[model samples]
Target: MDELKIPNVVCKIEVYAAVNPSEDPDKVRLAVSHVILETDYQYKEGSIKATSNQLNSLVKIQETIKKHRTNKIYRRQMRFNTKGDTTWFYLNKQAAFVDVIAACEEAEESAMGPIKVILHSKDLDKVVDWLAPEMTE
Candidate 1:
């Protein structure tokens, strides 16, 4: 696979996960970390929130989408969830824990709850294209 070009845009990316009584906080943090690079994590009442203002944070997700040939799925999710300058998607928590980036169409798809990733940007279309381009054979 060739190198992916990270979009140059001012955006705020946040990954959130609810920490259930049966789940370990550290494991939740690890899951979020695997998805977003160098995330600044914040722990609150039964929840974990991580934030990043750089497009580089999405590099791993971009690579995973290409590697798994899931670009259309991610692009659809992102566009479908778009509202104003923000769009969000869900990821399977268990898949993320093991360093696999999996996009979920709904939160209930993941047995242990899903990781919610939100993106806010004025240039949302550019960001989405960079993250998951329309692949052509």
Candidate 2:
């Protein structure tokens, strides 16, 4: 198997998830933690937020895409959402809570709510390539 290469690009990743009144903040926090491992988070009324500057922070996402064979899906979404130096995508919060990285094509796809992930980098194309490279059959 070919080894996955981590991009050398410098970037900032910001993740956000809203806590519905009926939802537990702790569970929401868990979902975020499972997705973006080992990062300090900020709790606000009805929301959870975290940020990281390291590419390794995306290791979970990279591994999940490879494991689930969803690289094409992610690549398409990331490219579609790209805006200049930044791009954003949504993940199913419920799947995240279970430590599964499931991407949401739309916010409504995630029943409870979706975790919004925003990525900013000088070379976003390179970042996207690293995260979801074209895989061969």
- Candidate 2 per-residue lDDT, tens place, 1-137, comes to 77688878899999999999989999999999999977879999789999999878989998898888899889989989988999989999999999889999999999998999899999898888888888887
Q: Report how far residue 126 has shifted in candidate 2, in Å.
A: 1.2
Off by over 4 Å in 1: none
Kindly provide the TM-score of model 1 when superposed on the true structure, using C-alpha atoms.
Answer: 0.96
TM-score of each: 0.96, 0.96
Report the C-alpha lDDT of model 1 over 1-137, residue by residue, as the tens digit. Answer: 57767877899999999999999999999999999997799999999999999999888998898888899999999989999999999999999999989999989999899999999999999999888898979
Clash count, one per candidate: 0, 0
